[model samples]
Target: MTYTVNCSILLTELPLLERPAAAKAAGFDAVEFWWPFESSVPSDSETTAFERAITDAGVQLSGLNFNAGNMPGGDRGLVSWVGREGEFKDNIDVVAGIGERLGCTAFNALYGNRQEEFSPEEQDELAARNLAAAAEGVARIGGTVLLEPVSGAPRYPLLKAQHALDVIARVKAESGAQNIKLLADFYHLAVNGDDVAAVIEKHAKDFGHIQIADNPGRGAPGTGELPLGEWIARSRELGYDGYIGLEYKEPQETAFSWAIREHAAN
Candidate 1:
C-alpha cells in the first residue's frame, strides 16, 4: 500500500527536478515517469540526476513507460508491432538497458494504435509477436514488462483487460515466457465498464502492476466516480502487494494531495 507518483502530469510543464520534489511535498515515497528517458533528460545524465532527485525527495523511481503515440512521430499509438518489428525489438532493448541502469525493473507496454486499414487480427498477432520478443529482452536485464490496455481510445484495437490477458495467455503458451504480465489502469477500466476488483481478483495471476485515475475527467482518486477505497480494500483482500500507481492531472497541486496524505496517515 505505497503511494506513488505518475509524472505524466509533468510531461509538458514542471522541470524534471520539480517533479520528484512535488511528489515529496505531497507525501509520496515513489515516483514513475512516462517515457522520461526520451524527453529532454539526457541519456547519460538522466540516471544520475534522477537518482539524486529520489534521494533528495526520499522517494524511489517506480518505473518508466516504454513510449506512446503522444510523442510526435511516435508509434502512432499501436506499439507499431505489426510492420515495425525490428524497431520494436530495438526499443525494448534500449528501455531494458535503461531500466537496469536506473534500478527500475517495471515498465508499461501499450500497443500504439495502428492505421484503421490493418486487420484487427493481424494487429493482434503482430503485437503478440513483438511483446514476446520484448519480454525476452526485458528478462535479460532482470526486469518484466506489463501490457496495459487502453480502452475508449480510438487507437487501441485490443481495448480490454480480458483481451490483453488472452493475448498474454497465447504468448505464454507459445513462447513459455512468464516475464510478461497485465498492467491495469483503473481509468481505462472505468471507461470500458470492467469490474476493477473482480478483474484484479479473477486474473490476479496475470497482473504485474496497477495504475489509477478517476473516471470521466481522469482526475485524482477522490475527484471522480472511482471508488478508490473499495478498490484498495478489495485489492488488499485479494492479496495484491504491488504498487498502486497514481496517474492523473490535478486542477491544482494539492487539491487532492491532502486526500492522499490523509489516506496515508490513516
Candidate 2:
C-alpha cells in the first residue's frame, strides 16, 4: 500500500482553522497540528472548527505535537510531570481526550529534558517513570505516545540510535505499555550523519511514524540534499506503510505545493 503523506500544519504557517483546507488543497491526504491549545484563535471553538474543516476537506489528522518546553525554553518541560503526579495525569488525560476528539492516533512528545546535572542512571529512571505514567494514560484511551529525539535534549542524553533504542526498550518494559512508539525525525538523523535507512532498518520494530526534511537546512525537498524518493522506496521495500509527515520550512509560499507534488510524484 502507498504510505499516506500527512502534512505538518505547524510547518504550513497557516492558521489552525485554515490548515486542513490548505493541506487538502495542496493534495495531502492528512494534516497534523502541533498543539490545538496553542491555536491563535479561541481554543475550544477553534479546535471544533478545525475538526470540521478537516472533515469537510476530507483530510485526516494523523498526529499532534502535544506541548512544548516551559513555554520559553527547555526540552518539552513536561514539567508538570516532575513532582505532581495528579497534575501530570490530568494533563495527559486532557491531551488524550483532545487527541481522541480530533482523530489523532499518535501524539509526539518530549519528556521535558533533564537540563540539570543528574546521574545518567537517575535521568533514565526519571524518564522511564514519567513515560510509564503517560503511556498508561494513553493506553486507557487506545492512543499511542511517540517519543522524539532532538539535538541538545537531555531526554536523549545518549544521542546515538543504539542508545536511544536501549532507553526506549527499558521505558516500554517498565511502562508495561506497548502502545508507545518512536517518531523518527529524518532531519535529526541527517544532522547526526547516520545512514537514515540503516537506522530505520535497525529500529523498524519500535518506529511508528516518520517526519522528514533535508539536512543542513531543514527545508522542503528539492531545495535540500536529501534523496527523499530513494528513502521512501527503501521504506516501502521494507514493508513499512505509515504516515510520512511533511514538516519543513518552505523558502517561499509557493514552494510547498511544488515540493509536495514533487514528493508525491516519486
lDDT winner among the candidates? 1
lDDT of 1 by residue, 40-72 (tens): 224657757766776687778777777553554
Candidate 2 local lDDT, 164-258, one digit each (tens): 56666887777567877777777776777667779767665457777777765776666688877677667656765778777776633654665
| lDDT, residue 39, candidate 1 | 37
Estimate TM-scores for all models: 0.86, 0.82
Listing every candidate in turn, what is its Cα RMSD in Å to the true structure after a full C-alpha superposition?
A: 2.9, 3.6
Off by over 4 Å in 1: 10-12, 37-58, 71-80, 255-261
Model 1: which ten-residue window has the lowest total lDDT?
69-78
TM-score of 2: 0.82
Q: How accurate locally is residue 198 in candidate 2, as Cα lDDT from 0 to 100?
A: 90
Scored by lDDT, model 1 comes in at 0.72
